[model samples]
Target: MKRTTLAIALAVLAWTAWDTGADPIRLGRGIPWLLDFVRRMLPPDLRVLPAALVGALKTVEIALLGTAMAAALALPLGFLSARNVASPAVFHPARVALNFFRSIDTLVYALVFVAAVGLGPFPGVLAVVAYTTTSLAKLYSEAIEGIDRGPVDAITATGATRLQILRYGVLPQVLPLFLSYVLYRLETNIRAATILGFVGAGGIGFYLQTYLRMIDYRAASTVLLVTVVMVMVVDAVSSRLRARLI
Candidate 1:
């Protein structure tokens, strides 16, 4: 069975590569042009440093605010969706709603909000909030459901109210995981916010798109570098915090 499965997977991969016109010969031919393009991006014109930094800051702000808003909204939704916390009636519907939210791409949300709210970082924030809420809520629900039932049973045995039980039992067990997930999502949202800016949702992506359109690879490279640095810093910090929490 394993051999058959592996053969099937390889066949599908080959078919996909062929269908997509991923010719190795074509790739080899493009190497020179690719190298030339890379050469053009060398020494990334630092003249755009100030503007790129500002955009990087704006991207961070959008992600932070959006993640905060999503956490606020997702917490209650998560509790409601958790099988151990909410009734089956509530759980099923809430899960369905989360599924619906997860189905739509974040870029689609950004575009829709840009139309609704007009162009700015606000639309990016809204898009991130919508996308992150669904994602975080689903993750939080799973965390809540997977927690140790020992404390939960003890609390329930004490005749504690549902809210009290959640506070005393559930929150303690899941808060670390919740924070880890939020931090991870924040990292993801930063990248997403940058992309959303291409659609005028407002972020470093605006500058990136502008520079690219004008064939200013130097300026575009600066923005890309700033984005990479910002994401790396956040990831490092979040990783440390998660380690401590766990």
Candidate 2:
């Protein structure tokens, strides 16, 4: 089994090298230019610091709004998708829809929304929502399905309504897991929200692209620095929150 696994890994590596047109000789020749580019980006322009700060705030806002919207919508859809909570007829169709949403990349959703709404943070928010909704729904349904069937069966035997069963039996079991999923997704959306601006979805990424295009390497470097710091801060805070919750 180990030999078979090693053979498959080697075959995959060879296919990747062939498909990507990777050339070690070309990379070796490009090293000097790469070093030169990094050299130019140093001593990042402090003049753009204020603008970068504003862009960072905007990125956080987009992520927060997107995550909130996705969580709100996912709650009902997730319940409907859970086999324990929903019949096959309801859950099967719901699962199909969730799969369809999951198949599309968030950036592609951003492009469509940008074209429809004509740009701004709104499109970025919508894109993240569309992608996160499906992801959270799938996660939440699995959590629901994994709950102790004993409580669910006992609750049902008590002549409890479906809603009551959900409240007393299923929700208590799954809420913590659901909260953890939301926190993790918030961290992910923060990073995703940064790039949505590239397609005019609105964020610091637009400024990054602009500075690079104008050969303003110092300003671009400042933006890159701010982006990195923002992501680090968010990740640290979310990690703490997740630890406490779990």
Superposed Cα deviation of residue 177, candidate 1 (Å):
1.4
lDDT of 2 by residue, 4-57 (tens): 999999999999998998999989999999999999999999899999898889
Q: Per-model C-alpha lDDT, please?
A: 0.93, 0.93
TM-score of decoy 1 = 0.95
Candidate 2 segments whose C-alpha is farther than 4 A from its true place? 1-12
Task: Give the residue spans of candidate 1 off by over 4 A.
Answer: 1-7
Model 1 accuracy (lDDT, Cα): 0.93
**Superposing every Cα of model 2 onto the true structure, what RMSD results?**
1.7
Each candidate structure's count of clashing pairs: 0, 0
Model 1 lDDT tens row, 12-105 = 9999998999999999999999998888988899999999999989999999999999988999999999998999999999999999989997
